[model samples]
Target chain A: MPSGALLFQSVLLGILLGGLYALLASGLTLYFGIMRVVMIAHSAFLILAAYLGWWLHERAGLDPLLAMLGTVPLFFGAGVLLQRVLLTRLRPATLTMMSVLLTFAIALLIEGLLGYAFTGTQRRVQLGYGSASLEVFGARVAVVKLIAFGLAVVALGTLYVLMKRTRFGWALRATIQHRDAARLLGIDTDRVAGYGFGIGLATAAIGGTALSLDTTIYPSLHWHWIGPLMAIIVVGGLGSVPGAAIAAMVLGMAQSLLQIPMGTTWAQTVFYVALFATLAIRPQGFFGGRLAQRF
Target chain B: MPSGSKVLKLAAVALLAVAVLAFPSIAPNPYILSAGVLVVYYAVLATSWNFVGGFTGYISLGHGALAGLGAYSTGILVAKAGLPPFLALAAAGAFVGLLAVPIGLAALRVRGASFVIVSISLVLILLLVFQSWSSVTGGSRGLVVPRPFQLTRPEHHRIFYFLFAGLLALAVLAWWLIDRSRFGLGLKSIREDEDKAEALGTATYAYKLIVFVVSAVFTALAGGLYALWFGDLDPVFQFSILTGSYLVLMALLGGVRQLFGPVVGALIVGIALEFFKVEYGDTPLHLVATGLLLALVVLFMPDGVLPAIADLIKRFGRSDRTSIREVSAAELREQRLQNAGGTK
Candidate 1:
């Protein structure tokens, strides 16, 4: 019953939102792919990055995009330390369970810390172009969202290159494919895992910063994001990068399209419904890999 | 393993149950009695969660949704349908239990981490639905639950304390019965290894679904009771992910596979949380403390504090016995030498 132009507009919005979701999910999928750790705290790190960007902007008058210069490296280092210090020491038999618990606890820790500092007040980064929109195909597209999409594409492109072109990328890929074989080939997998985790978190930093451009964030906001983010990655297949990217777009578009008929509130149900349908029909996910049965 | 030890253990358990039952009698005031009700509420929730989480090894992060559904189910029945509150509570449990079947069927197919993801999504979806559907759920304004009976404030608190305690006992009894049942062993086999369990002819799916529904029913009852006791209900508080997190934390912190693990875990966490709330008033400090405790438990004592303490006791016992063995061996050799001298 909706007009063609309205449908096009929804699709466009979905794609842009999906782009941000892709950025959020990329690190989560990457961590799972290589480390076999589900990284439930991925959104918490994203929130932390968002908070960091907000702080930098408020205190130093730095642009949020510029604030990433400080935020990304900090989260990157924390991710590496988390891997080396906590994750690596878990017993193999209980690794999956422990990692889930550990990351969940870390999420709580981050949320509680943020709550302590900010007192559950929702904060957003105010930008010059925040309300500015550009006309595209008779649809008004927000400038901040377009910039977010652009930034996400750039980050994902860089990640693609890093995973495919670099020697470290090869080592990372090799560790994921066959851990024992990669270790036999003298790959310093421990270091590679640390770097992989770092790269994963760095993506979260980029995503989080991009998110702050448009969205209001609070300490417990991670709970809202974590579910959808996981749904994206899982629907794409757990550890597959391309799968996650594609699934993120699909979910975004579906959510947007649903808004046409169901309105905004009910449209949010699309993610979980899609996730449930995906698991029921194809537990291996759309890309179909080893289903991470380690737990 | 001895009969005497078994009898002693049973006696200790009975004594603890009796102490808990009699707690409301000695409470200083209505405040403490209300706190006792909270502890019982958590014990029921945690133990119910353990049915699927601890036994079946399928961690359900959305169980609070079931509890929420139960609360709403009872609330709607009592407020809208004008049913008796007690009758509504039982009906709510049944309704939630039946609801779990379709949910479990969809969610239980996935294993390990995927299962966790699905479970979490279930809770999130329910939260969204309940929040948006204002006509049925009363939206954010929430619904007022009618108290089943009219009584003085102290009497009201005391009655709910006993009521919740009775539910906790039922939950514990269910867990105990399942712990010794063949069906429970099948569930445990699935926990240990699903494929092997299936290959060995266990109906793993059926067992899991049954337990999950059972868990849902009990959890729903607890929620209904909570609604009745509080005389008010909000979607957010009833269906909080924090509640789910606490349930998981309690089971793990106590000793997942142990019989009294959930109760012990709930008691510690519940009392500590209440204490923190009283001391700090309204702050996020309790959540921080909880997070720290959970992290420490998972990192250092994955088997849980109870199990770790039991191991420590066993270790000390072994060392003492080993030292005694060495002394006795030396004494035996000296006696043999003396006997040889006597023969000469």
Candidate 2:
């Protein structure tokens, strides 16, 4: 058996990584919640954000967080444009089904474009303290991960405030619950969906930057991340933010804990198994709204 | 009575068959014949995928995993169990088809976007499973698929070409039979609206599971065939999401509802894919091209290029004979006057 301190260290590391996971999933759940769009491209956009952050850091000598100042708004604008231009044309009758294919295509487009811009080579956001570790209570914590955790908490906290305190939040929530009903209630549901999509992608900006602190970034990196994010949201009950957040942490911790006994490759199976289990047992998820009879 | 369009379609099918058959003999060298093999492989995969995606309206991005499983099955059976390559492939198909039952049941429970997610997860999980199972699968490094036949390179290509082509014909025939069956009609109704189909007394779940398993079997056969031909089996390439996406793209591009949709789609896409591979050593610009093409297909021609072209042909073919309302009163009067003068 592993030492208790080592277990504690793994738990801490998992939680830190889980924060990053939740940060990315927030956008995906929001898209699903507001417009029923299964944005398969969300991870691709996140990778794009990571590339942007990495580039800015490497070329402009700017901090990745500082790079977010530029990327957040840029990605937001791009998200709004995409949702309005390409996605709005889809009728609600086939939105749920068609969105998956469309976003998948879009994901491929982004991955290809990113690969063209920066070849398929793996890259990490170079943090000066990436290797530095801090000891706390007999557990060693990597400094970069701790910073990534901080970034996630700050971004998620901001998201909490925005969702709770803003007038837009209500409209967003209304649309998420029921688009037609929200429209009947005199809310501009289309506009709400557009902005909500933007906000979801904006969260990806924060997520990508934080993720790059510890993980590698590449165009096809989304392949590895997209599945887990989908699992996270599904387990969290599709579009519920708090549910996804908790699930992300739990799954992350589980994966980390499993990694200690099994090697890293085997650990990846946990998310997929969790996803299958969740869909089979309670597909509406722990916090998902009523399941739609969609096809 | 056979309609004019029906006759035209029959001719088109005959022409496609002749062209497919002639390629192996007329090929200048082995390389072209090998590409022909790839086209047939893709056709078989896409046609198999069409059983579920085309008829049942469930788009699976994880089907490559089914193929990967088939390849692994054949590999393990041949290498570990000492079964002949051909027998191993037959066994592999049955294995994958049986495996699809529970997978389909679990995944088919949730429709639409959720199903897509589950399908993708199925593939990724298999990829992880195969990669980590080092003892059996040989992990990421993969295993050598022993070539059973002792033939020259071109002769080998020609053999597999005909073999894969034979499978394609068999699969297409199966799809055609299913397309006309009561089961197929029920599947289409489910695609249109599962709830309505269920309420109306159709066993929607049973129909979907049956078709899903059938699709998995054909897909597995194609994958196993590819594994045997390529003489190598790896987790990354066998379970590639990109290949799965291509299968979807090919089916969609050809007109999912049509009998020959996937065949046409695979021909066009397979050639284009090969072109890009040759043009750009490995830049992924081809992926961008395919992505743009997919987006265009979804936006402009959801029913696929074949249907779109057929519509245009139908419109043009009947334009002059479409309606009597197109005749002006003056032209009608002139026609009547001309008829009277001619009678006099």
Candidate 3:
């Protein structure tokens, strides 16, 4: 009973949102896939990037997109250092509990510092193009979304090429598949892990920039992003980047559609129900082949 | 000698109970009394959480949702159904325990990190449900239930504090009983290695379910008490991850594996945070402190403050045994060999 134009608009909006979701989830899935680290700190890193973008935009009048060139490297280095110093020591331990506590602590620290500096008030990156829109099939779509989607596609495409074609990428994949075998073959497993973490964190920059374009940023955004990120990772099949992309789209579409039928508060519940149901049926997830390879 | 140990334990329990019973009267200040009540509440929640999270190694991130279920259920019974307070509390606990069964079945199929993911997802789902179902759950504004007993006098307030203290004491006793019971041993075995436990003919699933349901019951009871104390029930207060963090922090700071660890940890952390709040007003310093403390505790003292203190006590007690027999390297190697053989 929905209008065709409205339905088309919904689909387009969903795709745009999904692109951003995929950008956020890629880092999470990559870290999990390559290093077997859940990286609960991922959302915190994204928030950190968002804050950095906000700071640059406010102070230097720099575009949030331009700020990524600097923040990406900084977060990448931080991620690598974190893995080398803290996570490396906890290897072969259950790591799950410790990781949760560790990442939660980091998140708390970030949120606290942000609150102290910026207060709890929400801020948005006010780009000149933020309010610009394009009319399509009797619906107006924001130009920022289009730009964000374009950037996401470009970034993901480049990442795909790097992951599938590069020598380091092969090593990363090999290590994920069989650590013992990879080590036996003289691959620098530690280096791969470090770089994988770095790359994972760099993706956060892309996601944060995209996010700031659309929504309001606050100290609590880390908490808000974590639930959706976790959902996407689980539904996509942990450790599968392409699977994450597909799942994010599906979830984004589902969420957008649910918003039209059920109110905003209920939209989150629908996604979680779908997540639970999916977990019950396919705990390995939709693209679980990669997961099985590791297990 | 074993009888002496048992007597000592019983004496400790009696003394602790007496001290708790006398605390409200001893500390007449409303702030201190309220803090004491809060400590007991967290202690109960933390101990209940320990049964499944520590003993079974399930790490349920959604326990606050379970507690919320209990609070909301009790509130509805009292306000909508006109049930008596005590009866509503009992019903709430039972209902929440029952609700945990299906979630347990679905979640426990996965091991390790996957379990944590599922638990957290469950929490988010429940929070959304509570927020969205305005007619039933009273929406974001939430329903305010009347106090279980009117606090017309300071004596009445003292009585409620004592009541909560008693409930906390009961929860502690229940946890201690479970800790020493055969079921506890089964749980420990499963935690050490589930495949090994299953190989040894332990019904891992059944024991997990039992521990989870029992934990849920205790958590729900605490929730009921919370509603009674605050005279209000709201989704944000009940189902927040902040509540979940309270349990995690208490368990971690107290010593996850120890019986009285959560009790000590909850009291210490709760008091410390209270002091911070009083000192700093609404500054974010407390969050920073909490984060730093959490990191330090996990990194440096995984056994928690209680266990660390226990170790110190044991070391001091053993310091006089100068002629204690020490294992030779050969003997230790032989022991390792035997262990390996036994495992094989």
Give me the candidate number with maximum TM-score: 2
Report DockQ per prediction, comma-separated: 0.41, 0.38, 0.47
Q: Tell me how far the alpha carbon of residue A237 in candidate 2 is from the true structure, in angstroms, after superposition.
A: 1.7
Minimal lDDT window, size 10, model 2 chain B = B322-331
Off by over 4 Å in 3: A290-295, B3-10, B319-344
- TM-score of model 3 relative to the true fold? 0.93
What lDDT score belongs to each candidate, Candidate 1 first?
Answer: 0.86, 0.87, 0.80
- List model 1 lDDT by residue over B152-176, tens digit each: 9889999999899899889989999
Against the hidden reference, what TM-scores do the models get?
Answer: 0.93, 0.94, 0.93
Q: Candidate 1 docking category?
A: acceptable
Candidate 1 lDDT at A129 equals 77
lDDT of each residue in B236-273, candidate 3, tens digit only: 77887767876888898998777778887888888887
**Residue-wise C-alpha lDDT for candidate 1, range A140-162, written one tens digit per residue:** 89999999999999999999998
RMSD of each: 7.2, 7.2, 3.9
Compute the interface RMSD for candidate 3: 4.0
Candidates sorted by lDDT, best first: 2, 1, 3
lDDT of candidate 2 over B165-210, digit per residue (tens): 9999999999999988999989888777677889999998789889
